[model samples]
Target: MTYDAVTEQDPLGMRGIEFIEYLSPHPDDLGAVFTRLGFRLVARHRSRAVSLYRQGDMNIIINADDIALSSRTVQDEGDQISAIAIRVANANQAYHHCIQQGAWAVPTRADVMELKIPGIRGPGDSTLYLVDHQHKVSIYDVDFEYVSDDHNPPALIGGLKFFGVVQYINPESTAEWIRFHARMMGFRALPPQTRFGILPQGTILQSPHGHFYLQLIEPVGDALFDAEWYEQLARLAFGTPDVPATVRILRERGVSFEDNEFAHPDTQGAVTAGLSFGINFEIVRCPATPESP
Candidate 1:
């Protein structure tokens, strides 16, 4: 009833993001991209159209079905983050709490797995699944029907862990989202002027444990993106221990990256040195920089 006190003394009751999900019209294409990025094809859902990939502690899901986009192709952009999974002490309890806070239920189709993965709506009609057994019992086996029984998911690449996602919202919508995460998920906003790439950024929100941070940035002034809503949410930043080394390993695997003069590894929206299926991941220096520097 108390939601396990994940947020009591620890406000934001935040746990790390459980997994990142993508809704792609070309599942095979996107899967190939991830594979090039060092992710292995792990398991498939028994009933729903979903596949799981693992790299280090980061989990990524590709939902092949257009159901994720209201029976339509979501978009073509590669780096877009369609959904993020959050680890809760108890998924059902967390789902209930969010629902009580006026969160809408996102439908999930369960097949092989006897368990039901609960999800709720997030910004931009995106979904946030409550996952607790990400590393527990063979969730893929119980829920997913893999094409090959011997297929194993790939190991984490470059010691990369999910740091947090970059959410680009309207110039004035910042306060609404800040409150949404705080009330519905127990996230605590960090101090101001926390910067990341080539751009000057804004307030940061940390998970309850202080292990994860989501950055909220608004376009300069009343400037809003002329693109679709989903296009704006595509910017995802991954944390890596060594930016230079991580870039090298990915390049050797046949991945392409953006290396223009203005959009270099040190620039905003610039993916590090790795490319997969022509898709690249933005390089973000880890929050915990070497103090010796």
Candidate 2:
């Protein structure tokens, strides 16, 4: 099979993963954090306690309802990213495929004026929802009977694009989870010895177009004892064309990063240009072009 054939195929209708949502009991605090990151509150779910925010090129959702949709434990902490919405060609088809592949269906608790959003189980008990924005119809309008005229998507900033996801897995369970991704989704393990900076030591699976990646890392060194290793899977690394500019924008906005000049990318793990929510963000060198094997 060709290289594209080997990786997970985007099933024609599959666009990239759209937005990652966080369900926080402390929605106000979380909203404050994101606003500092240059995100504007764009829309709200009709009847649920959920709101959508958008920045240059990213969309973030904050769900504060006590409804337990995923198998995860949602503490009031600002750490967890509870749900992710994948842009598919057909939301219905993608949902059906996931269910046939043994994905757990997350039931909707829509109110009288709410939309019934479809979701399935993701790794670490996360929720993955399929959204179809292929047509001009307003997604929020059909599913969400909102009355707001504020209907606009985020404008993608700089060359900032989603490079890939960094997922943490148990030390011994890497192979099992690898199989799960490979079979359930069309993910393939990178060559065994390839490595990235200091993280993502497990396997790397590329999407069909190679625009996004899923990097799996098992417990290594000190990470072994942390029972919450899987909880860290929600952390994402965004690739930018200009790290310094991004950092400047973030720093000015009161976003704090873990800076350590001794490190390769500096003392702070990721630089945020004058942006808030700096702790939850990281800056990577320009994304290297994806090459086919």
Candidate 3:
């Protein structure tokens, strides 16, 4: 399918990340890591082996359901980011538009009790889910049951917010991926002078609504192709008003951070030591507004 640019406006009416999902064979193990990072288990999926954790405005879905479609893709990878759900004005229209833009659709099979959420293939085996944020009903309202008495999740220490996600791309494929996001999803490349946190060696693309970002990192200096790394969504970065204070708070919670000359903690940013399944989190010194210049 070929989709022409529908309008000058963002075709998807994209807002921000609804949630970042991780598929794992061991959900409890990964759940511990999230807990130490200050997330609270708020809900459980109605029909599957899935749970939702929240911190402030950020929502993370941990899918350990063996029967779930995305779980099959990450079964061998131990624990990996399987999908990123994006909030939009209309889920159906967004899904159709992306497919017309040459994006491959991931078939949906919602049961009689569930809502049929549309999705498309993303880099690697990941899926990009389209969810309508303007609707009166929420996707979780239909699929998940609340486990917490308090619906509002408390703020994370040091005022953390979703900064962006780091995606490992194939060597020399940066331009191609950039075009895919630009044409299909309405992401715009940032200027070279604008950098975020530490470990800044990638092309940063901001969502149309300027809420979150996608950092595309190509393998460095003639690096051989590693199927394990190519086109995979690697680490998640959270922006904090104070990096040192955030690190201190996490350290108190028994989270160890990498402390070295190049990547040590500072006002600019900090990197956490490898957590479950080589998943590391980056603490960047950025405003709550991630799209700010």
* Best of the candidates, lDDT: 3
Model 2 stretches with alpha carbons more than 4 Å out? 1-8, 69-78, 142-150, 153-156, 192-200, 261-279, 286-293
Candidate 1 residue-wise lDDT at 103: 85
Tens digits of per-residue lDDT for model 3 on 178-264? 999887778888886678887889899987656678899988765555545567788889888888899999999989999887788
Candidate closer to the true structure by lDDT (higher is better), 1 or 3: 3
User: What TM-score does prediction 2 earn?
Assistant: 0.79
Q: Provide the RMSD of all predictions against the true structure, rounded to 1 decimal.
A: 4.5, 4.5, 3.9
| TM-score winner, 1 or 2 | 1
- What's model 2's lDDT at 139? 55
What C-alpha root-mean-square deviation, in Å, does candidate 3 show against the real structure? 3.9
Model 2 has a clash total of 27
Tens digits of per-residue lDDT for model 2 on 1-293? 43223223554244566787776667777788778766778777766678877766577878876565343453434446677777766778767877787778988666665556688867776777887756476556554443355555454457665556767666777777676665555566778775443343567776555555677767777777865565345566666676666767766777665555533343223633322232355566543655422
lDDT of each structure? Answer: 0.66, 0.62, 0.82
Candidate with the larger TM-score of 2 and 3: 3
Ten-residue segment with the worst summed lDDT in candidate 1? 267-276
Q: Give the C-alpha miss distance for residue 223 in model 1, angstroms.
A: 5.5
TM-scores, one per candidate? 0.80, 0.79, 0.90
